[model samples]
Target chain A: MGEWSNARATSEAAGIGAAGQVQVDDDLALVARVQAGEMAAFDVLTRKYRERIFSIIYNITSNREDAADLTQDAFVRAFTSLSRFKGQSSFFTWLYRIAVNTALSHLKKSRMRRFFSFETINEEMAPGEIVDTLSQKSAGDHSAQLAELQEKLNEALQKLSPKHRTVVVLFEIEGLGHQEIAEIMHTSEGTVRSRLHYAKQQLQADLQSYLS
Target chain B: MKKRRESRHEVSGGVTLEQLLRVKRAERPGPEFWADFDRGLQQKLFKTVVDRRRSGVRNFFRIVLHSRSTYAMPILAAIMVAFGIALNRGSGDGPLPQAVTAPVDMVVSVEANTRASSPGAERFVVDLLNSGGESGNFRKVMSLGSINTPDAGSTRYVADQLGSVTGRGGVLSMGDSF
Candidate 1:
């Protein structure tokens, strides 16, 4: 993604970027229901976003178990903090902010033994054009080739520092725009772009063999 | 045909970094994982509710800090002010006493030996000044023994810090005050 493209879009539609009207409205209603002593509504919100949140944390941690644990903690924190949610931003944005912070905090606190468990990719996208092209070059079956690519990708991602990895994950993988990520990271849009640039350069260097 | 939307930046190979990294987006866990994830979440939620109940002090303080800050603010300010006052008065903080300070005027006693060396008119003036004797409250500033008078003859001369020998033992003026 071009840095100026995000900057121009954010500038054009400046002021507290609302995600989408219907989704924001639904989230607001659900949040109100949760505030009115309805635990089921919180369950609904949790169910709605748990997969996406888990994916974000999982990409950062490189461990499915740690990602699962941190995801639950993020939800619990959001539920407990529902009263203070004055709908300044969309509930979606707020929840993602909490999840990202929870993951970043866990990474900082624990000098954990690095564990990388390359889980299976989505079956639907496994036959995509990019994977197909790379698979043809490697001398192996589909499963073996996918595994090799995943290991290489994760290794390259892990080489980046946590902040830089977060930028790449949120921008490229999550498809989040600059303004939203800036808000989540509590930083300037320029900083996010810089981190993304640096992170991409580092990934390119690390995966030189695979890219070649 | 999603022609792998090209970015302006790319490697020597055809794959752009964004296009290459987008493959990671498919690393999402399948539906089966949520079965156990939901089960563990329910257990953790129950434990969190119990823990929140147990943390009465934390919630109470949080409420006090958020809602009742108007009242709490004054109390906090008062406590800080009291602490500052106590610290100021602890030690090495008050003014010195008046008696501990040096006096304004200084007096020099003229002995009989000095009078014998002087002429008669000067001797009369000196005698008149010394005649009052040691009647007033005077603090000794220094001894005039360093001057080495020809004959001391049982009379001692000294400088004292007396405000004024107005009607009694008059303080001989020495260039106002030494």
Candidate 2:
């Protein structure tokens, strides 16, 4: 959901520096509630995670339609399989596993690349400093230039192999630490870092026109 | 590779790959997207997940490699024990005890990796949570563990997890509705 977080949520900007324990504990408690036949608890989780689930998938597939569908499927999957979710990993991590696999499966099955449907770039989030420079560089058409840059970025991302793109999305875009991505991807931290490096190198080359 | 070069690019002001990628950060769905998302999820849960209970438990963890890697990973989905197991593993991150007491299986543990075995084989993998992984490169990583649904949709169903069909339910994506 949008802007949907409990009051106990840590500052999203601070990145859960010291309060991670409190958050994870809260997740476990919610997991306990949902396992106890509290459908509403599951709903709480869906609201908490749906946007995230959507974003990861959206970035991976580069197709808004597939991302939206896969996100719902991932949540529904998480809900139905609620009984199996032993709290070994954080619930969000568990949910993420479902989401990534869902996207991979979709990518594997359809193997059909459709027209890319990207989400709108939130104007507020765009770095004004960079936007201003880019605007001047691109003939002062600020919004249009940003939109083009957005498309080019998505295109560059979509060009990566699925695995590389997943790493890039998680590490670069998602801002997850290497160890966390390793655990989520079921790969080693080395692999995460390696994939991230290669993915970035490719992106850097592809978008050199903009970055340079 | 030089450590500094690997980390950042000093192009005058130096726009790191991470910063350039922030453009992707700017791309996010608005509230209307969430409203449709809830509706879609409720509908799919009603359809496919209910139908998957009989497809047989996933006997093996499909640990996809990056076109390069050694060995495999196994997750607990099939052969994942049956019964109403309690998640009373005390509060903390423990490996999920691989037991599926249907209707009420509580997986509470401090271990990060959940274990699952392949029947009639010695191979096992910690691949239970791969169907979808990673917090949506959250526009914001609001680690709100205690979450509540404000007008969350309703459609309850029971069945096995969506292992293969995680991508089957094709809901019409939100178009220009962001």
Provide the overall lDDT of each model, using Cα atoms, as 2-decimal numbers: 0.65, 0.61
Question: Interface RMSD (Å) of model 1?
Answer: 29.4
Candidate 1 deviation (Cα RMSD): 31.7
Models 1 onward score TM values of: 0.61, 0.61
Evaluate every candidate with DockQ and list the scores.
0.12, 0.17
Query: Per-residue lDDT of B1-178 in model 1, one digit per residue for the tens?
Result: 1211211112224556666787787777777788778766765665555565557557765666677557876776676797786556433344323212422222233444344566576775555456443322121222233223321211111122122234335533322211
Q: Write the per-residue lDDT of candidate 2 for residues A58-83, one digit (tens) a residue.
A: 88898888899888878878877877
Question: Evaluated with lDDT, which candidate comes out highest?
Answer: 1
Residue B43 accuracy (lDDT) in model 1: 55
For model 2, residues B90-147, the per-residue Cα lDDT tens digits are 1223333221122122122201233433332223122323312332211111111111
lDDT for model 1, please: 0.65
Candidate 1 regions exceeding 4 Å error are: A1-19, B1-13, B57-178
Which residues of candidate 2, in runs, are more than 4 Å off?
A1-17, A135-139, B1-14, B48-178
